[model samples]
Target: MSDPHYLREAEKYESPIPSREHILSFIQKRPKSKRQLFELLSIEDEQKKAFERRLRAMVRDKQLSCNKNGVYRPFSNRGLISGTVIANPKGFGFVSLDKGGKDLRLSSQQMKLVFHGDKVKVRLLNRKLDAEIVQVTQTVKTLVGRLNINQDECYVVVDDRRIKHEIDIVELIEGCADNQVVVVEVLNSPTLEKNASGRITSIIGNYLDEGVEVDSAIHRHEIPAIFGDKALEESAKLPNKVLTKDKKGRVDITHLELVTIDGEDSRDFDDAVYAIPSKNGWKLMVAIADVSHYVKEGSQLDAESLERGNSVYFPHRVVPMLPESISNGLCSLNPELERLCMVCEMEIDSLGSLLEYKFYSAVMLSHARLTYTEVNEMLENKKSKLRKKYKKIENNIDFLYGLYQTLRISRQKRGVMDFDRIESQILFDDQGKIENIVARKRNDAHRLIEECMLMANQAAAKYLQKENEDFLYRVHPKPTPEKVEITRQFLTAIDLRLDGGLEPESSDFAKLLKNASGREDENIIKTVVLRTMKQATYTPNNEGHFGLAFEDYAHFTSPIRRYPDLLVHRAIKRALSNKHRERSNKMVELGAHLSMTERRADDASRDVEQWLKCEYMRDKVGECFNGVISGVAGFGLFVELTEIFVEGLISVRDLKEDYFIYDDVHHQLKGQRGGRIYRLGDLIKVKVASVNLDDRKIEFVPVSK
Candidate 1:
């Protein structure tokens, strides 16, 4: 059944009266007042109201707009721009321009008609940097939120903190209750006079359910959770084991003592490593799962994998890029099983410099499955029980460790910045509640595997560069002048100095970090220096990576999880086949899309972690703890508690003794009357005031000394 409003809109051209097209044409030809339109159409007194209604509808639909002169003109005539709305939680928003100019700000009143992530066209008002939404081209259709029921009245509060509006629920699904997490499908978009309305589509779980937070985040970010039917069907056709035909043109290295080293909980293994000491250097072989072999270009499986871009990992579960039949079955490099892989064989000198390398398709057997903990134990103590259990392959592990040390020396010599920051790991009880949060320690085994993968990736990138082929290079741009100057001022204020000029090299940042090491404020200084750099992204332009200090770099080791790595695999295969392939025409668009998906995964993971942290802190509201001042703003100080590493804000209003003023240059807050100052890295005691799960925020207040 077609909607009546859509029917009216569709048949607008067939109307006997002045059709919408005719009205737009007339307005575009010459701007006219409402009175002028009425007179020009020669309408009778009885038809005046109908004509006025049509004009109003046209304006509401954004087909036409009214200027300050009280004259109507077609919206397409001139001076209109289209962009995506980025709504703020404060009931205002900014439109990121499609043509790359300053973002135009929209007032709270103007924001009432649109939701976050909507696409709209706007006309700049006479006021500077402000615009009014002329039409909504696209509306947010599905949202993940929590339901709030008041007897017969209900509304869904959106999960995105930036979207301040609540959607009125016109219909409800069975078994849904108040404070339940749900997925809502918008039925009617908001207008200036009324809030948007939706119907609950699916109840994920109760708000406090064990895994509901991650489930909500998955839906909220719109990460592709389920594979399409065609993709799954395609995956089903793949063989369960590698056959002789599959390895026809591949090298057989089944005798090599290669092992897969991963976390204890990891199920899918994508890489296997083997190294041996040579006369002049070491011979390193890095075998990566050949995902490109099973999933061909333009296939349904390939399309779905590209859509996912990369696998999203939560602490409890994983949303894989490919179906389980492929990602965990055929593509995983399991131990003692013959698997297809792409091997990078490199010859490195004693100084850890890559002498040469070659890439080829191969059939390899992983000798054993190893864990980082066991490997670290073996390397640290040769007589350990686990070391004796795996003594048959211990020599190969030692060779890899030696290669890692050499590589570490080379990395240090190259002046690559390595920040030693603490990463937290959550331990869950049998009931799925967090038992504790502890800092994860990275051992030599982790660095060994990392250095091996780095060597393979660098070799692959250099191979493509030598052939002058177009491929996606992982590019990290230099910091801007403004950021560098700000960093310089901050360091100077801390009695330190940055040696490099305006455009400092990565080595300069490395030197500054070395100087700040072991100080009480080391973590704070490292964080600030990291903030002064740009995020690394994928591009075909071949800009060097500044942080890794690599002239040519690409992600070529994780094809089982990352789409760009799959593309790299395909490019390398083409090169091996003596066919120099050109870059895909959609490379730029694909790069941008992949970057967005990466950010989406990061944001969703962060959101879930924050929600879990907030839930964990809910019970300790009145407890006091020592913390460091991590951030300062006009509103308050952000303190990260030392005991649990949780951060909360101490609002300025709670500082009742004096009025606080923010000092931006020095990154501190000062009390006007009390003369007390709180700056970054200052240790203080704070009492937890409140926890708001809806906003994912924790509040704190200073404890009187």
Candidate 2:
């Protein structure tokens, strides 16, 4: 039968035709003439013209071959490929192939055919570095955009900057106003002849709205912020509080002095810790909320969490992976409340070497909920007021710090790469507008919690590796040769060496960071070294973690927020029960999907942060401030201001004093006349010249230093 994906093909085109897949499948048996295909696939007289276009397009894309007799067969060439289009804001894009290889670049002209995140089949050009779109198999159905009214015409400017086309709106919703933000339901994608068209589905108000940025970002990133009916129903069915039945066959640790240390503003507590001096060194118990117990693999909540991949944390809002009923209630380890948890108990030596570890299901009551500031103050001063106020867990905090000191030694010995970059905390005014931006300092208490989590994650990874289960490990591959060489050039230009010839170990990077300590350019040096390494991703293969310097690593903490951690929990539970499941095929797809969702969340969060920062700086035009060069490019320098953590750009054209030449190899700008050089990490003075809220851009001009 010459049938295709009838519903899908019908949705994609005005007139349905036999899909490339279906035609190819039919032709696999034997070559077919046009008349035979028309008769077999039931192509009518009116559809023949449209079907001919598809066939010709397929032949041009190298998906099929047509002989002198007009007979068609599958194309034997390997030039054809399928992948997702990752578009850039500059009107160009690249195809990230399904079978991994170098991404094929598409020119701006070719990009007009498809939107960002659309799945398409492409044909590699003769140069091999570029590709042309053969067909858009899947188009983005909905997009977030701002309504633009140009005289008699109305269109939507997509919030996702990568999608360059403005979708035309033939009909407007009743309340549509000029410059309003809206969600567009895509009707048809753009062709070479015309622009994209859509219908206004959601109205988010003006861009200046205090909370519209978050909503727009959620839609642009396709983040599932609203819970589906099925998911909500499932969540509502869950117990409001941990029931006695939930603790069956679990160890009772209610008497233990377990406490949670987190940011003061945090609501959902995923992990609680208790440490005691043991026979060898110390016994540390890390109790994580048992989210997997409630979010079963086949449940709607599980599907929702898997789709979300992880919690998306914006400045003040959070799109939690699990609903509030679970993430902030039953699965949350609140103080003085009994909660069911999966516990990782570890026995470490005085040198912070893991002697032994065990995992079990447990019911525990947190003795106290302590903030990081309070814990740090209590540890720094034995006679502090906060210490007296939290007297119940004072000794418990001491035990945790002692173990932290030992773990610090272990971290240094293992050559862990530490990138202590400045983190910004964005504040909002009473009216919900951005008030200020400030650096969020990391204290010893923060480090203590991080070390504890690291230890627990390592224990989990070791257990999974030993159990020989098909589980996801947080893997960090070695740096690419191109990035390493660029980093080496940058470091050498500053009279520093990265030590490693081509493939450097984490210890080599640690040495470079240690050498740059206390230098004026320390922050940028750390940033450069950090950029040289590849992004860490989850994989079924245990390729090890480079940043943490661990041979076996998996995300085992914060299961309530991260889907991978929940999966790890399930794998551990299954192993403990001596059950074997054959699903290695699914793990690879799962890892890739989780990685993509994580990236999507990060990009969405970053976009919201940028929008807020731009809003914060909108009124500061003409104000002068000191800034350090954080990023460099052919266009200009990205400068982060001193007191305020906001970033602005100093365009090359604004450098009127000199005709500067950008040296991408060494990441610097050299004056064509005066021999002056500007490099990343260099401190400079600049005045904010302009701020464009629509483009989310800030321009700066150099001020006399």
Candidate 3:
């Protein structure tokens, strides 16, 4: 049956229903039969049904609703729905409704008035999940970046690229400049036509400056590097040394001849090792700075540490997790001063199998702060100055070196794969300019510390696993079939193939690396193989780490900087006190957040490194260097330089000989004009054609004969 069309023949009556509101009002007063409704609407019987259908649709759409009897009433559920905005870098966003059912797909046009992390109220037009942003509820904090100035007002461009709105500044702040990054408090949000207004609270600094590393670290982790006065004052109250009362009934290993080994300029010595040969195997003790002893839970310092999650480190500076009073003094395992520590005592056999392990809270004193260079020199030449100065601690250092060699062999036997990836350490001159990019080499001493830490972490993981406790687990899942196939193809091209089928174990990977060690394609194959594996992430579930081939794994040794390690310490303490069974939901939540923040820190560090590297090469444009094809894309191929660890792209258009097509199955580019093929790991010479600081990108042109 056809429904009544209210618009049709409406002009015939003098005082007909004036509008939809009037018609709705007329129908609300009394119950109207179909015949009466037709007369009221002034329409034919067929048209009456159409009018009824239209009324029903309006009610269902929340535009209108029918009363219990027969009359119509306007929907009462009106105003707005509040939600959080999750935006993508592509400008589009999704308003995850707080009232909660399904998310509304907010287009870039609708989101033009909003920014990420903003609370918004949107009037839903349809139930199809695709809704427009009718209005914004509340604006959250805006990310700080460079502010663009105009005649009367200025716009504050956000550091977060996902934000599309520019906030207007009333007047110039004290330290804000053209390219300098600053945090602007959003006073007003821009709509379709209006602009956002903001006031500068803090100036980060010139983004191009070396000091910006701290700014990037803080901003990236969403942590406040600058501590509040109250927090700093609270940190000042901490004691300079462990009190005698706290050391009662605890093992005082202060005179154990322990030595700290780290970089030359490291301030906080969190870990110090002492080792000696035993009849059973080796007696190794790893003593970590007990920050927990000083920074008690729920204290100001502890709260701030929880907020920061972890310490952020750049090349030149480290934003310590705790105040310098603790990290560098009281809590630091400095020599002469007795410090509290959570020590891990372990017994290991000659083949690197741990026989027994014990954890304890104790008082320890470091005998000396030994730098890697000093120890390496002492090992290389016994007659060196360092060997003469620290002659007493030479036995312990030698024992540690022997243990590290044995541990490395054990790790290799267990099929642990280590990719020898090259990393550049940027050296800065007196003017805060990059003097040179030095490729960092892995040395025996470095590996020694790493192996010791790895052993401690493994022991921690095993302890947690045996306890059947719920803790933050470091897990790395296996590779995907597609990635495995790709790796296979690349390996086959390099005249090497896995003995097993597509699904090879960690041992297979280790053997492959060992077979290709010192070969031309070693680095390239390592890079590709690494890409095939999944990223290591922290989860509550106990899936083992595939890369390390560990049945269990958790970070334990570096509590000063890593939150996971702190949690592990807490877990260990609870287990020791027999209170580990009482679990808190909040701790688990904190672990997840900490893990996410750690990843964010790593990404931010990488971004700044790329920027600095590009800035370092800004003056060296047109210089040529030998490189290898690291990656191939549709647009270009990425080349990593041999001398300097800089990576740049070789655009396809620059290969002017012929048109090239990316061969996906083979992982190469085939040229049609000259039958030339460029595959992964192909060594080539490239010239630095240009550098784009805006995007932190570099362009390279292939150097041809």
- Please write out the lDDT profile of model 3 over residues 1-705, one tens digit for every residue: 232543553665443333455555665666454446666657654555556666656655665544324544455545467899988877898888776777877888877888887888765544345455656677876466776665665777666656767777865667667777777777877778887787888777776766774584466347657788878988887777788888976788988988899987788889989999999879999998877667777877777887777887777777778788878888777877788888889999999988888889889989989888878887778688887799889899889988888888789878988886777898989988889998887677887898898788888888877776656777888887788888888777778876557678899888888888888768887888898998787776778888988888888888788767777887777777678654457756776777766776676777777878989899999999999898988787999998888999999999887899988766788998788988878899999999986556899998896
TM-scores, all models, native as reference: 0.89, 0.88, 0.82
lDDT of 1 at 418: 75
Query: Ten-residue segment with the worst summed lDDT in candidate 2?
Result: 123-132
Off by over 4 Å in 2: 1-79
Steric clash pairs (candidate 2): none
Model 2 CA lDDT for position 342: 92
Instruction: Name the better of 2 and 3 by lDDT.
Output: 2
Between candidates 1 and 3, name the one with more favorable TM-score.
Answer: 1
- Per-residue lDDT over 351-419 for candidate 2, one digit per residue giving the tens place of the 0 to 100 score: 998889999999999999889998988988988998778888888999999999999999999988888
Model 3 regions lying over 4 Å from their true place: 1-140, 150-153, 160-167, 174-177, 188-197, 206-210, 468-470, 499-503
Using lDDT, give the best candidate's number: 2
List the lowest-lDDT window of 10 residues for candidate 1: 1-10
Q: For model 1, what is the C-alpha lDDT against the true structure?
A: 0.87
How close to the true structure is residue 465 of candidate 1, measured as C-alpha lDDT? 83
Cα lDDT, all candidates: 0.87, 0.89, 0.78
